[model samples]
Target: MGGINLNGLFIKPPSSLLAEAYDALDPNGNITIKWDIISWTPDGYVAVVTMFNFQQYRHISAPGWTLSWTWAKKEVIWTMMGGQATDQGDCSRYKTSPPHCCKKTPSIVDLLPGTPYNQQIANCCKGGVINSWAQEPNNYGSSFQLSVGAAGTTNKTVKPPKNFTLLAPGPGYTCGPAVVGHPSKFISQDGRRVTQAMMTWNVTCTYSQFLAQKTPTCCVSLSSFYNETIVPCPTCTCGCQNNDTHPGSCVNPRSPYLASVVNGPGKNSLTPLVQCTKHMCPIRVHWHVKLNYKEYWRVKVTITNFNYRMNYSQWNLVVQHPNFDNLTQIFSFNYKPLTPYTSINDTAMLWGVKFYNDFLNQAGPMGNVQSELLFRKDKSTFTFEKGWAFPRRVYFNGDNCVMPPPEAYPHLPNAGSRLKFSIFIFFMTSLTLFFLFE
Candidate 1:
């Protein structure tokens, strides 16, 4: 699914774009939308629509998913539950009882929590958020039921909706044309009987990072106690500052309007009004080589959120390091190994514990999460020489962070020669002293 721009062959895509194009762990990852009509109405039919996230790592965060499609016929939504249309549309045509929505192209958003029980159904009222398959498989899907009117009651007469679009809070997913598939099977809650949908149509959507953003979201920095130097994020790794419009300028931390702007409308949106910095990244990951033990080594990782406008919930980090296979213990974070290359387990998925460090706050004193990783050393491969202790690649919430070059990493000091010479001189001095005393 990860392909170059057909029109612009000269352009080279970023490694993050290519590295995430396919998930070896889940080859058929996608968010599938299914419209399953259960019963035929006098005018139309009742459909129970389901949106399932089969993607292993990608999830729909706050201000969740907004699903839209163009109705094939003059179909108007009569009643809806579990979700509501953003617009009621023009219902003036009906004098007595207006349909829930009367638009030819209706946009629907999931209802928030605490919805009325009568208006709720299975897997509804999550404020539009959907978890990824691997992180929380049980919450990977959401469902809503709706009543349709002014449409054919039979499957042969009814045509499937077209031009499905998914705004998982933002643009990046492209959905294919709805294709009628095998009838979906349903069962009673008590497990007494089984039922099947009258008709079923599915829409599978894939993601492309190129369509998501022009700039990177996060970056990485490094430090080690052995060396005084602390490597910073590469210049303009996310984006560079400019003297032009608001795009380049950052919000002042003490600005008077800060309160209003951040808590204003669309508070849950992904917009980042971050602080001023050379890297201009919304998030920064700092890895410090903390302590070394005879049989083990420890590393401290800190994730700081510079985005003052948004808060990250259920955030996760993906890292690639050869030592992850030898990971012995991790503090304040949960770890899961990923084997994308069959047997090689150099990759790891780490996230904060539930209700603890799971929420990465906005830019402030409390806007960071820290964890210590301890790994058992393999004498053959464990060495402080060069940059062997650092991670090969790091990702923050699925965004690849720019790391300092190999040459810039903290290098081990070459003090072995000085120690050897000093030992030789000491031995010579001891021999002379012994001869004089004799």
Candidate 2:
């Protein structure tokens, strides 16, 4: 009979025992769970399970459990411990061992009779589990508890979605609704709540909009003291003399002494006729380049009236360059009308400047006009040692100036020429000796 009884107990499946345990749980009773703050720090704290019970059942499997707390009336803290078997202890190190045999704290057997179980929860919060809890102890004082069972049992009270208010105008001039990627946040006046939203500035300029030809206006502050009030939009143009009467208009007709030289005939071949006429080639342009900064250069161009007999009434000069990544301010002296134009052509940048003067007083016989141009280039593509090969074209009154050729080096005789000269000398000597002998 004793042998039969032992055999019967051994033959009973483990599943039946598990079923019995599940049925013993009271469906109407709450699964009571208790938490205790074991250790605390300024950043966070270490918490443990002091006691937990489900009817009289000591072993219970509660997976997808969560602990939550209200923080600072702004943030809701949640700590999740994924699916775990309480009979074997939630500790990963002793997961295969029975709860009573688990050395780690928070063992199921340790908390079976409402006894406190000490163990550190892993990945509880942002700055480590313990540090995260200690970060705001004052906030944790309000509502800090643990829920055992499925994830649904945890507090999931949804708060109102945050809204956004424009603090001030962004780098862009206009503002609109928030965007997805760009997030911004601001605190309330009482500092109790924080408003967060994905904000984006309005489109300031687009590819098609910039390509369109229109008057460009810049936002300028009216008063230096306060950055408010959009100043009147002024039309921008490239030219000298920006007055109310001649706004955005360059002075035309550069010079008055723009006439060709003429030769007068002598009167009756006896009295010589003196004639003073303007020459077509009155101005001579001299280009001077000097390294200013890293890859920047100061190009000083001097226009001199080399002709001592004629004066230039109007003149126009155009200078070009290879690259103009950043063109500095242009400085011109003795020239009234000047305009700088920059355009992108293919892969290179084309920069042109027209220097003109309507009055002849600025340029007279033996007079000179000077202007300085500053520009930057790619260091790898441009260097002072390689020499400035730019100003691909320079036009003086529609005529391109001919660039002077580089200086030539002295010629030297090679080995082949020396051998040929030696052979000729040998033949000449042999002929002279034969004549002498004869």
Best by lDDT: 1
Error of 2 at 186 (Å): 61
Model 2, range 80-179, lDDT digits (tens) per residue? 1311223322334433432221212221211121222232222222111110011121111111222221112112321211222111011111112212
Give candidate 2's whole-model lDDT: 0.29
Per-model TM values vs. the true structure:
0.85, 0.25
Tens-digit lDDT string for candidate 1 (80-127): 999999999899989998999999899999999999999998889999
**Candidate 1, position 53, lDDT:** 77
Candidate 1 local Cα displacement, residue 370, angstroms: 0.8
RMSD (Å) per prediction: 7.7, 35.2
Local distance difference test, each candidate:
0.83, 0.29
The ten-residue window of minimal lDDT in model 2 covers 4-13
The candidate scoring highest on TM-score is: 1
Lowest lDDT 10-residue stretch of candidate 1: 5-14
